[model samples]
Every structure is written in C-alpha cells, then in structure tokens.
Target: MLIRDLPYADPGVPDVRSGRHFLLWLGRRQLRGQAKSLAWGTLHMASVASIPIAVGLAVQAVVDRSGGGLALAGALLALLGLGATVGDTMLHRTAVTNWITAAARVQQLLARRTAELGATLTQRVAAGEVVAVSTGDIEKIGWCVESVSRFSAALVVALSVCVGLVVYEPELGLLVAAGLLLLIAVVLPLLPRATRRADLQREKAGRATELAADTVAGLRVLRGIGGEELFLRRYRSASQEVRQAAVRTARMWALIEAVQVALPGLLLIAVVWHGTGLAMDGRITVGELTTVYGAVTFLLFPLRLVQEFAMAYSFSRPSAARAARVLGLRRSGDGAGVGDGAGGGEARSLENPAEGDLHDPAGGLLAPAGRLTAVVCGDPDEAGRLAARLGGHDPSAEEDPAEEEGERPDARERALPSVLLGGVPLDAVPLEKARAAVLVQDKDPVLLSGTLRELLDVPGSGRVSANEALAAAQCADVLDALAQGTPGLNGDPLEARITERGRSLSGGQRQRLALARSLVTDPPVLVLDEPTSAVDSHTEARIAGALRRVRAGRTTVVLASSPLLLDCADQVVLLQDGRVTAAGTHRGLLRDDPHYRAVVTRETDDELAEGTTHA
Candidate 1:
C-alpha cells in the first residue's frame, strides 16, 4: 500500500476490528519508505516455494528413468538455491530499515505534539508517561509493523506450496490443506486471552515506571522528612506487583507457544501417515508422495509465521492502546474552554489592555509605569490562585462585568483575562499584544540548563548585558559561588551546566537566577510572586534596591510579605478574603492596618505556633 493510504486507514474506525487489523493499519503507514524492501521480501518467499515444486517434478522424472528430465531437474535445483540466498539477504535488510523508520516517526510525532501542547500538556499528563511513550512504546509499535511484511510474504509461499502438493496428488493435497487451515484458524481463537494478559502486564509496568520517577524526583524531600524508607518500601511493593503481573503474562504466552510448536508437528505426522496409505493404494505415485512430504517441510516456515503473528500481536496490542490513550488527551479548548480572549467580548486597546480593577465595575486600574505595587491577601492559596489566573494559565474566578449575564456560555469561551498594562485590560487585547505588554513571573520559576548569557538573552530584554540582569537580581554573590574560570576546574561556572531541575545550585542561587532571567525580559508589566524568600534580610534589602533601580519606568508588582520588599513599593493593597480591603503606602498599612501587620509581620509566626500548640 502507498503512504497516503496510511492515515486514512484508521485502526480506530470500528469497534469490531481486531488487534491484528489495527496492526495492519499501522503497517500500512510504515510501508511507505520500505516499499522496495517489501517487494524484495515477497520475492524471497515466492522463490522459496519454487524449491518444493522443482523437487516434485525432479522426483517424477527420476522415477520414470528419463535422462533429459534429470538434467532439467538439476538446473531447477540450482535456481532454487540461488533464489534462497538472495531473498534471505534482501529480506533482512528491508526488515531492519522498516523497524528503524517506524520508531523515528513515532518519536517525531510525540515531540511535535509536546511542542504544540507547551505548558498546558505538563499540567494534564504526567512527565513519566511521556517519557515511557517515547522510549519503550515506540520500539514495540515498530516491531509490530516490521513483522507484518515478513509474515505476509511467508503466508503466500505456504499457500503456494499447498496448491502444488494438491496438483501433484489430489487426495494427499486435500489432507495437507485441511491440516494447514486448522493450524491457522483453530489455534488463533486462544490469542485474545493472551493479549488481554499482556495488556494488564504492560499497564502495571507503566505504573511502576511512574512511581520510580516520582521517587527519584522527591528523593531529597523524602530523605529530609525521614520518609525515604517509607517511599522505598512503597516503590519496592510497586516493583514486585509489576513483576508478578509480568510473570503471569509470561506463563500464558509460554502455554500458547507450547501449543503452537506441538500442533504443527502433530499435523505433519498425520499428513505423512495419510499420504503413505494413498501411495500404497496406487492412488498416488511414490514420487508424488515424496513431493507432498517436501511441501509440508517447506510449509513449516509459514506455519510458524501464522503462530508468530498471533504472538507478536499479543505483545503489541497493549502498547498501541497506550499510545492511543496518550494521543487522545484533549486540548484545553476542546472542552468548555476558558475564553482564550483571542476574539470575543468587548474590543479595547491592544497595546495596554486594562486590568478591570480586581473585578471592580468602576473600570480597570491601569498599572502606573515605573512603580512598585504590593498585593496583600488573607488566603495564601487564594492569592496564589489569583496569580495563576492573572498569568493566563487557566480561567480565574474574576469575571468581566461588561459582558451581559445572559450571554450563552460556550465551553470555548474564556473570559478576557483581567490583567492591565498602564491601566489597560490585558485580555481586552490580542494575546500576542498582551504578552508583549505584561509578563508574570510565577513562584518557583523553572530554570532550564544553559549558559548565563543564554539565560539572559530573552526577547525585549534590550541591549542590557547578562551582567546587568545579574546585577539587578543581586546575583553577583551567586556567580561567585560557582567556580568560574578556575584553573584545573573542569568547566567555567558561567558556562557550567546545571542539571535538568538546577539541582546543582542552592535554593537562593536558583531563585536569584530565575529573577535575573525575568529582569532580562524587561517587559512593561512585571509581576513577581516572591523574589527574595531564600536570601537573608540583608541580601533581601540589597535586592529590593537593585530591583527598584532596574525596574524604574516599568510597572512592577511584588506579591511578598517581606517588609524589605514592601518598603520599596509605591503603593500596597491589602486584600481580605478575595476583595480589596485597604489601599495605601507600606508604612501607612504598618501603622493603620492591624490586619495587615498581623498577616505580614513576625507576630504571624508566633500566632501560628500558638495555634499549632493548642491544636
């Protein structure tokens, strides 16, 4: 089949379709690059069938004592031998190519899908499942495809041999045909159970893989909390469960294999016994009897093919199902989507979309440029939740009052996100325009492994050098912690590679590094969750000044409890529950707002300890 036909051949087209059919659909997709290989593979099986036919003719000629017939038979035998060598070599080469290409395509599809999903994919699927699909599932899917071509060609050769045996001696031919049919059709009914068992085993293995990944990621936390042994025991139990499932699957497969090998041998014996009786009765010539024997001997190869197809499918069905399940994860907008704010609701200025002031109907508040704003909250979770909402991750509870209450709710309709740039509703503008105007740096910002220069080279960061961003985040001390340009050191710290999660750096170092990267962006609107939680008060104070200098003329929001950070803000808003309770300068709240002081100061710690003691 051609490559274009592959995508249209949906294995998921019908519920009634078997695993083998799904496998065939997958095979059709892979056959595009390996068409020539498949053609050569077919020729090899056809060439093998020629040997049995040539032997049968040669036998009849020798029995008749014909000299010319003997010469022709020898020539045919030589031709058969030549075909065998060529076919085998070409078959091996093609099969290997198909295997590698199928694997590569699956890998490419997964990577493309991941890129398309971006940050949203991580929120929905586990990291370990993605890891498992790329590494293990891809190989299994490839094996299933490559085996189809090999088995198809062999099956044709087997049928051709059976027809030849029937032509040479009709009565013995009938016996061979019936036996072969039984071998293929009757034995296959047992496979569904085998496949089901294999599916269970693979699922258990995937769970084990996920657990192992979790343990590795939380290894430090587990140890610090004295729960390492607890987690280790849990992982050990999970591993044992996987092992038990695998063993059960193995037992079922082994039983099927035993039947596969034994049944074919039994059929051969029965055919031989019946054919000999025919020869004695003069219903078949002695040479004809010999031809039937040769045919069955050759048919052994295809007989094995039929059995292996069943076995290969038993192993591959689970893997295919898993891949399908992963691909089936719906995109965010595919359901009742939070309005992407791309094209709906009221149109407004794209450059400085207003943040409709905390769901206040008195129009959105424009963030004044080059100023620091403090946001206080009673519920830390609620505050964090609002931050995520503001960042345009998912829908926030804050809704727009401009839209009529009776407007039809479309699952795809996302309320325009209420973020403002210089008093403009960020969602009122196009997403691309909004992103350019406002940037929210979340708590625990991820630091990808890269050089310091690479990290600071964000778009719109201006011509400000890496050193400047580092200076802004007060990261000079952090840079010193690294062994930069030291002789006998394996690498420069400025160029030193961090691990995937930046595990090599201290918490403060990572936080500062993340902060510096954000500073390098220099977007008009900067919202930082907590920039100096890791550093001591002295370092925090220095960072506050550095931040003020770097962010002058930029609208920056610092959602922090540190007085040092709040002391630098131009204004502070105290939010109780979900609504704004008070708005004033940092010092104004320290004196006039007892609730603010109780929530923000060290007395908050004493109160928490007292509450814990009472509990």
Candidate 2:
C-alpha cells in the first residue's frame, strides 16, 4: 500500500479478542506489504551471503594462478554487489512503508474510537496512559509489525548458509552449524529475564507519565494550596523509580547483548582456528578457509535481526493490550458503558429522538418535547449528574470490570442499560446518530483552540446560522475577545486564533463561545448544565430570553438555579436530594415550594443568619 492510501477506508474492526490477536490482525491487514518485505529481506540477505562465497572463489583462483577463474569471480562479485544494493534499498523502502502505513492505520482506528467514546474515554483510560498510547505505543506496534518479515528472512538465510557451508567443507561446516546452535541455546534462556526487566521498566515509565500528566492538569489547584512542591517531589520520586527500572532493564539487555556479541566472536574465532587446521591438513584449501571465515561474519547480521524481532515483540505486547482496552469500550446510556465497544454489525440509527419526552426514572425528571425545561438543584454537582443522564451516559460505569482490568471474560453477552429516546434505548443506537439526536453541554464546557469560524463548524440542522447562534448566546463581547491583537487572523474575529483550550478568553467569554458552539449544532434535544454560570446576571437574563425564543419548539433541558433562567423556562422542576420534589411554573414553584425558593434565592450569609434567629 502507498503512503497516500494510509488511514484505511475501513481500518477494519480489529480482532481485539486479545493483544496477541490484535497484533496478528495488524499483520494480516497488510499481508501484501509483509510479503514484499519478506521477499526483499530474503534477497538482501542472500546477496550478502553470496559475497563471502565469491571472496573464497577469488582466493582459490589466485592460489591456483587461474586468470579465467579470477575474472569470473570478479564479475560474479560485481553482480552480487548490484543485487545487494537493490535488495537492501528495496528492503528498507518496503519496511518503512509497512511501518508508516501500519502506524497510520492504528492512529486512525484510535481517533475513530476516541470520537466514538467521547468524554467517557478519558474517564476510563488514564490521561497518562492515553498519552503514552497515542505517542509512544503506536511506534512500538509498528516495530513489531515490521520485524516479523525481517526476522523470517534472517532465519531462512541463516539456515541456507549453514547448509551451504556444511556441503562446501564438511568439517568446517559442521563446526559452524554447531556454533550457531550453541548460540541459539545460549540466547534462548536469557530472553525471559530480559523481557521481565523490560516490562518492569515500561510499567514504571507509565506510572511516571501518569503522575506528570496529573500534576500538569491540576497545576492550578496544586499552586492554590502551595502543593506544587509536593507534586514536584512526587514526580521526582516517580521519575527516579523509572530511572532505576530503566537501569535494571539496561543491565539485563546488556548481558544479553554481550552474550550475543561474545558468543558470535567466539564462534568466528573457532571457525577460523578449525578451518586453518583443515587447510594445513589439505582437507580444505587456503581460499576455502577464507570463504568459511567470511560466511561466519555474514551470519552475525542475521543473528542480530533475530534479536531485534524478539525485542520488538516484547516492547509492543503491552501497548497492544492497552489499545485493545480502549477499543473495547461500548456505548451505554447508563453514564458509563460496558460491552464490546464496537457496535455489532451496523449500529441502529435514532428514528425519531424528538418525538418523545426524556425521563430519568431514578430522579423522576422529565424534559418534554418542543419545550424548555429548567431543573434546579441545591447542589451544583447534582445538576451536572442529572445532565449526564439526560444525555444517556453513566460516569459510574467507569467502575465496569472490563474497563478496570483491560479485559473481561464473558463481557460481550451482557445487555446494556440505556436511556430512552422516543421510547427507544439509546445504547442500541449508533454513537454518532445518538449524539446528533441529543447534545449535552456540560457546566464547564471546554473550548478548543481555533478560529471562531472553525469552532462553530459543527454538524447541525442548519436552521441556526453561526451569527444567529453567536448573537443568541450573547457572544458579541466574545468576538472582541477573539480579535484582540491576534496575529494571522486576516482582521476578522471569525479568523482569530485562540490559544489552546481558549485560555486567551475570559471565563465568561469562553463559556459564551462554548454555548454558541452548542447552539450552532442545533440538535433535536439539548441538555445544558449551568450554561451561563460564568456570565453576569444581565447577560444570563439576555441569554435565557434568547435561548427560549431560539429553541421555542425544540426540546431543551437547562440545569441551572438562576432565577432569571428558571423564570424563562416553560417548565421548572425543583430537584432535592437527587429526586424531583416539585415541578411547575417558576413563579408557582417560588410561591408554593419553600425548598425551591431557598435554592433559587441562594441566601446571603446575613439573611440566612436572620432566618435562623427567627426560627
């Protein structure tokens, strides 16, 4: 396959039956490339092997003072050099092609899975592990894939050379074959220890990566409490552990490498010593002895390739297992999903998501179709939780046995608990379809760094234009924020380049921009949690009015306690202790429900104290 054909049209659902299976599947996926690599590798090694034979022919020809034989040897040597050049060049080209293509396929599959899983992927897979997999693990997997052909070619050529030697000069050939076997016997036992050390080093390194990622993500919080030093100490400790583990692994591999080098050297020495005796005894000529020595040296390269294959496999096995874990996350409307992540066959589409009300059986909350519903909870966290459920997700599923352990026996047979959309289980529906049907905007939505136009470029019903959505979300000031001395923006706020995570914008601007992005999507159902928490009361009032007018006939669930927003809702529900205690018009709830009033008012300290004194 050409580099242009990378990221397969259908990276073909991997056989994640096991890590071993996944790697095998990668091999099978690029069978034609593998075969080409094998062919070229064999040719390359074969050409190199013939060089020693030609050298021996030349020596013998010169010893016999035969000009014709010498000329033939020179011609053959030139031909062998040409073959070697072509073979080696082609081998490297094919191997690199295989590496890049395989890596691209893997990266695409990962991106697809990430998009499929959405926010839940990070909850299940540690940030550090995800980073490691994306950055480092893919390369290891590519190495594993490319090594198979190289190793096979090396083995075949090594065996052929041994056979040729045995026939050419039986005594010397027998000695060479025995030495090769002895070398194998020596390296075989060292692999297990070396592999163990490598695994240990990998595990420590992963832990260090996780610690560093956590520290960076929470750097603000850590600094607020003067805990930066604490985390720094922790990171240093983890890093030192990684260093120690690496050193141990290095020593073990060093032992193996030394054995590889020393044993081969000993074998070369023994071959030369034995061949010299044969030459003296007239069993083999001086030129034949030279040929034997050269052949022994050629075997060294193939032998090293064998070790390379082993090292590649050992390093990639863990990475494959981690990748398998990520690919296995299934969609569940129950907060966190647990199943074979890939929807079996084609995932069913949502026929009519807006045709029915969204009901949360546990909390007795219902957001009706073609209307705006406001849910107020005393606890902000409770509102966030309700929002996740409304959109058909369960964060609690992070506790799933399959996710925790990376694999589970008999996980595929279990049925998924789902959120109902139009009286249909959302888990049974495809992720892309379900997401398009119901959009969930979290309380703290993140803004991706990009041009303002790029941010609003989302799949939507197209009923709401970007300018309209931005206006409705009260993002006029946000537009100014985007255009603030930004370089390469073409003097258009829409072309402004926001910093990563939109850090260049104020908290309120970022919130409004995120809200505008959500509004632009214009899904059939929208679950927005505290969409205006960062803005002032005036902006919040305006957004609440605009939201109601813009989404007049679309289902919108706003989980917020702001009185202005609640007053604008067609239906306001008061939730208490994780249950819907009351539901009615905002004014009616305020008049009749003391708990609702208390939550909505968000009493000042003095007012609460006066009320307590009166009580």
lDDT at position 221, candidate 2:
65
For candidate 2, lDDT tens digit of each residue in 1-615?
789876588888887756688899999999999999999999989999999888988999999999999999999999999988998999999999999998998898889878776665665678798888787889999999989998989999999999999999888899989988998899999888877777777778878888898888777668779999989999999999989988987887788889889998998988888777888989888888988899999999998998899888888887787777676665553222322254432222245567677777667788888899999998887776667666766544443434433445434245324567765566555566678889998776777877788889999889999999999999888777667747666667778777777766767888898889998999889989889888999999999999998887899999988889999999999889988899999999887766687788877667756765765
Stretches off by above 4 angstroms in model 1 are 1-31, 34-37, 156-168, 184-186, 325-442, 445-451, 454-460, 484-493, 496-500, 523-531, 553-615
Best by TM-score: 2
What are the per-residue Cα lDDT tens digits for candidate 1 across 388-484? 4444334332223222112323322544335443334434444455556667776666778666666666887484556788887778777766555
- lDDT scores of the candidates, listed in order: 0.66, 0.82
How does each model score on TM-score? 0.75, 0.86
Candidate 1 structure lDDT: 0.66
